[model samples]
Target chain A: MSVLDRRRGEIGLGDVASALRSLRPADADDVASIAGVLGFGLRAADLNAQPAPTPAIYDHQRPLTPQRPQQTPSHERLPGWAMPPLLPAPEPLPDDVLPSQIFRESPLAGGGEERPAWLGEAYRLLPQERATPLRHALLPARTARGVLVAALATWRTGSEIDVTELTRLLAEQRMPQRLPSLPVATLERGCQLLLDFSDSMVPWWEDLRELAQQAIAVLGDDLVSAYEFAGTPAEAQRWDVERERLVAWRPEAERPILVATDFGIRGTPSLRHGGAEWRAFVARCVSVGAPLLFFVPWSRGYWPSHLGLHPQIVHWHPATSAAMLRRQRGLSRRVAR
Target chain B: MSHYTPRNFTLPADYCFRGDPRDPAESAADPYIFSREAVIAVDVALATGRPLLVAGPPGCGKSRLAETMAAVLRWNFVYQTITSRTRLEQLTVEVDHLRRLNDAHLAARSTSPHALADRDEEYYHPGIFWWAFDAHSARRRGLPESVARPRSEPRFPGVERKPPDEAREGTVLLLDEIDKAEPDLPNDLLEPLDRGSFGLPDGRTLRAQDGAQRLTVITTNRERELPPAFVRRCVTLLLAEPAREALVAIAAVRAPQAEKTLVEKVADRIEALRQELDESGRRPPGTSEFLDAVNTCQQLRIAVDSPDWEETWQQIELVTLRKPMVTEDERSRPA
Candidate 1:
């Protein structure tokens, strides 16, 4: 019992009323407890008599008298009437029959709804697998698209009329200007998704898949071109969704390249990745004017320093958000506001 | 720059919104009782000319606020529900290429080609923003002496605007369910919303008249997170689930012919159902559903204590109050 209940014997109605008369807002709970204690000392006539409320949620308006189900079926009560069964009864299985044998004989037969009460003990607790977003996410799902949009979006001339340009055209021609297009900023140029499937990245395979999905979800399937490589990006193979085939990977000029890699760390010794082959690959990207971005799961310490700023490396970590990317680009800090 | 400073408009604190219930318009709203704080938010938005971004669950009368406010203020009302494919140009303005092309073809075919006034004003189609800014200019497609005929002003079916008199012509633009739009849609509206003006293809800026007053109200179900830039610019009002007393008051106003006892009984049931549904992590029955239940009881004459009404009442609960909610489906399932 609460300590408030222990003080019930000493407290009286006048004491409770006096406590409430000067009750400060802060001490309201104490006064409430005191008033609750005074309720115990009330007579039957002191409190007005009231009927109990109907049970809520179900049967709130149920009839007063208890109604029971009919003991006999209508067909049984009717002497001359007969009704056909809707569903055929299943043949009973013997207790000695093995579960495997039963399954082999009747593979489609699942458990019926009318199971024995004791069978409830046989049921195992199946814990639910909840899909928590961004648990294993390298790039935070909410901010992933924002980061890409800020990073790779380019300006292209649009077919819509530009008032400023139209004004100039009309002034020069000395007449009413017809429709003229203007420059519009958008993410029209799609990106290449190069995924690392080396032995070192086995633990982060799911993350790679999630990264691809997030990229696709942001840009769209047609925009996110897919490529897969075991250890070396130079030897990467581009896969097509429709033809179900793989082709040699090459960097498209002016198209941003997003690579999910670890720079060949913890791979087999024979696999010569992140070496001269990687440098040549970087050189090819530079030649083609492709803006390469590495979504490396490893920290900056693991990245090769010899690449010389040709490709930008974004730490593929949970802490990586659009704000971090913006800050990295020397943009205005949101915290300053 | 402020719309309120130069105007004679004043929103009384004691004002209660009594909309026409008998009108069967699509945006027809019953009497709305604003929470004490909601009225303050409305005042803030009104005084500052900022869009009141009302965030609430579906069917909590967020959309109806604009229509009712239109009636109360005697301002022009423009209603448009946003979808995923909604473009910013469609809201502000768009050039009628087809109409312009047809005009050009007719001018070329006629002997006196100059007879067809091939002007930019004739090809311009003013959108909701244009109408809200200056209704008169918008009717003529933003040109006073345009050769094209004036267009009909947009309005709800049964809403009759108070005839222009001493009060200046103003507008209430309702962009309902804005969260359904693409993420950039809100950000794209920053300029037009802040300045009360948008650039036209005809090299003219269609600006809000200095003498006219305007208030924009946007409602969202929060299906997507709005950009912070967009949210910060607008005054926000979050509509909470009404308390029991408020619910009863709503029912009394919405269904004035409904019996008091029946309304009370239905309100009590709604309270219990709301509690259970909230506990189960589901959206509770909102104000719209409450009115529906009360109306069902009054129309069918289903008494809470009547044994004959038991099955019918249960069926009503199944369909109206709880059918689609996941937890509600569990109760009537086979044992």
Candidate 2:
């Protein structure tokens, strides 16, 4: 047991109060005032002798007895199915940490004015063979640099930069203008630097880890980022197990497994179903771990605010996807622990 | 300085190759050498402007074929010897100390109030590909671009000596042993090869703009696959070892004094040995090897029937072989 717990166990509440009362002044003028307040010759020990109040008990049977017969409506205002009880006023959500504070602290956010970040960092561990195809795809498109810069910023700030804002910044930078017609080793190196910094420093953010798992569900474990899980020491041990499960459980290769959220009714009007069913689906998503988020549909209200009201649900952006978030979350847990 | 100038080479009056480019019929004495048909096919490709990738085993005369093309076309021969250290700038001119000094001198001379100095012209040594394009254009057109001088404006003043019109007329650029160039070097050629134009370091482009075409012949040992982008741009032709008759023709060329019986015997034996190697999936000696053996006998003055022929043959074989000898164990493995 802790020191505070043990010490508090030995002291009685009355004794502590009595001791506190005794510490008060015994000045000549205060004696009359003390007498007036305490009555006659009441001692500090007597003040401390008061008993604690007893809590009231609630009767379970009292609410069941119905007594209002005078206001009986004709045929109970037409027989009808009872409406579900209204939900209690929701507790206000805890204010999220400010984006500015998050951005300032995160190492993923890069500094162009300063020295290049991730210069000395080890990139996120991935299979070396992937460097080629990734380069091939990324080089010709010239989108790799922007994605990498954002990833670097993600590492720098240790927070998720709003992808929209990041994309905007990249457009303004016109990074592609200065680059070779085809991105080459320089682009590859930039990507490596970003991965290295993120892997060594920020690791996976919580939302991203959850998304990764959901992604794994939709895209098979053969996907490049799937192997990223093996980088962490703890996850490394589970790599084989997870890999084997995924391979065995992988859906038909011809068909992509769709993993979008219901967000209440917006995703499918016909599949409205029950709130209980939604809760169950959410629980399954949490257990499945990656990428799956339970959300209230836009039909109910828009995104973060809608998802935020439900303590059990999370907002999964369409672009970010749930499976990726799960894997990132998994990575984040490994980093945090 | 030399007697032969840009106008010395002229297209042969009788162009036989164009008439029958695909015919497999060979030169009567040497079937192993390219049939006149093959030569014509290459010529047609050249005329139509195609970059030919000559691929074959080592010593199959792929490199020599380019030399022959240069000769036949009567174009100036320019060679770039590539090594591991070869880089992008080596293939294209970049800012160097010489260029910088020239720039500084031009800036100073143009601005100085105390009468401008007539400075020595800067001769930017052009790369093999660029130089061929530039020099060839200059020779055919007579320095039209070179004659038009800029006024040496205060901002971005013109240098006294223009970049060398190193572009030679009808230069057949032979990129020999192209496999040796660094990975990214070939990709750099795409622009110049595609458009027949390249930009200079000074933000000016030198074009073969309706000038004599620069014939480019690239030879490779097929060490590795070139990038698909580069490969797609070239006319690919693969060459194999020449036949026994071709070998004899090659021998006759190399050793004119050697008896016909000796030459035939050597050719037959070499052909048999090469067949055995091929059946066993082993690398065989090239036509160069056969020529080497014949040259050795001629040099040593040994009779073909002499008992010492075997001993002398072994000694000659060692020097003649370019590729590593395939061991029996390696030959036994399925290709």
Candidate 3:
């Protein structure tokens, strides 16, 4: 049979050969030229019906919409936001207590009864007297995934915390459930709760702030830090001003950590400005050595004991998760050694 | 477009690669989102012509991104959707029975010793990969058919006198939902992706354009990580959930008639639900769920805030959060 009838399916060696033979000399030359570039060529068709031309692989598609300009939400527009004024900053913790503390915790200190029952036994076996809280929670990595693991630690710290376990805990805590059902109002409520907690009603907030400052001292200005907040437009504006102030004072060499506090209910979704603006906040933190943290309400169910950032993220852990606490103790011991 | 036949399968028209479709109010203000990250990823894949792995929770727009890539490249995108049952032979052409019969007849009638000597070589049928390969080869040769015919055609248009040895320059191949396939399925692509040729079970290897061929994009839902050996052959891109406002903007575009507040509310709810699932160690709902959920609400004319439709609305939410898995589980369960 001729090459045409010898062809298999709509496309085959015989069909290709026949089509190539049928092509005009120019077409054949074109194929030859392309083949030359690709280091191959089509076999010439024996019969005269022109071979089908090869399809073009790359075609132009309509360009996506250009990125929106960076918007700085007005202070009035920010939702229930508030920012600590840029003043004489309190001294952060010693270097031993910062990122280095991640490795010092007790791996065998804690476990959730349902998720991980081993921690209870581990806590019992440990020499440390303060092992009660350590027995209940797992490390962030042992429980969470994604951004939540890293983000969670910044939200709440257990009696003992490890930084790297944040992402896993956040992932475990926020996945499929909290994120999908989270309401805008609820987010706002969470932010309000955070701000309200700081109003001196809760001794825990003060103690936590002191510990945070101590940790910040240990890590230095280069530590990457992240925070999550909820609030109304007014609160968002307050945060905007505070964030701007922090950016203005930040040294060029010491990058600022990302502070992912909400702007308002209706303001910019993601806003970045300056090497220090709210937008580039996360990247700046990465440049430094801090873990980004978020502050939300206990009720929001998103208090990730950890948050996961990019590969470069240095997660912080809290006392809530047992695994993190144990790791923290281990690291502390190592530093003492 | 005319050369391809009308097929029952087509991607949704209003597909957006980023953000939520169920909520509009929050998203309307920033309706246009140019994902520099995603765009750069597509560019990198095109430049290197390497397979891309996109992983994320559901509704992160992994599949839509593939479609968007096809559109942007202006290529005749062909998605070879795979399931658990898919085999390598299905992608590689199997031996054709009709061709085998013709070969046998010819073998019996062959009077010449030379023709009879090669009887075993003629028993194969050209498979889909070969069809795509040959068609791509013809198009690179500047054949008129390549420009006009989409991939849906029954017969790849235009016959030639000989098989073309040249490979096409820019054909785009989308391996959709590859996670649904066997875990080892990715290994099947290693040789073809790297060498530009696939070996058949019969021992014949088909080479497209000798080595230069189409751009291949593989998508996964991150159900499991592929073996490192296979992953080394590809560039990886991880997709994250967009913020609520971004989703709202997408919703406005897809559901223009819906009230903005209503859209925002829905998006918020969906986001909350997803996070909750994540927190609970459950798989979050995907972008498809968000779209279908909104469509369901619209069809029933139910207000998102109304308490009367709470049960139905919750069901819709659950459906989105747990799709094919729950459905399949239900089917397999004993009554």
Q: What is the TM-score of chain A in candidate 2?
A: 0.18
lDDT of 2 by residue, A1-337 (tens): 3423322111233432342254242453333222222222332111111011100111111221121112233334211111112234469887886555333454675665777578768888776664433212211212221222222111112121244554665789753332122212211111100011112112222222333332322121223222221111111111122111111122221221122233323344454334553344334334443222232223333332321221223233334333444454456446545
**Collision pairs in model 1:** none
User: How much DockQ does model 1 earn?
Assistant: 0.04
* Model 2 misplaced regions, further than 4 Å: A1-337, B1-33, B98-123, B136-169, B276-282, B322-335
Question: What digit string (tens of lDDT, one per residue) describes model 2 on residues B1-335?
Answer: 11111122233332211211222243111212454323432543353355766667778877666555555544456666554345555555433334444466666787644332223212233465555666533232222355543223111110011222674346567777665554456777777766666666555666664566566777766543355566545545556577887777766655678878777877876787786655433457887777777776777787778988778766665566424444546544432
Candidate 1 has what TM-score?
Answer: 0.53
Write down the TM-score of every candidate: 0.53, 0.40, 0.39
State the TM-score of the second chain for every model.
0.84, 0.69, 0.66
Best by lDDT: 1
- Prediction 3 TM-score vs. true: 0.39
The better-scoring model by lDDT among 1 and 3 is: 1
User: In angstroms, what RMSD does candidate 1 have relative to the true structure?
Assistant: 22.3
Greater-lDDT candidate between 1 and 2: 1
Compose the digit string of candidate 1's lDDT tens values, residues A53-135. 11111111222212212223533521111111123335778879655633345476657757778876877678889767645
Q: lDDT tens string, model 3, A35-129? A: 22121244221111111110110001212112211223444322222222223435887767534434566577556546656755545444655
Q: After superposition, how far is residue A298 of candidate 3 from its true place, in Å?
A: 48
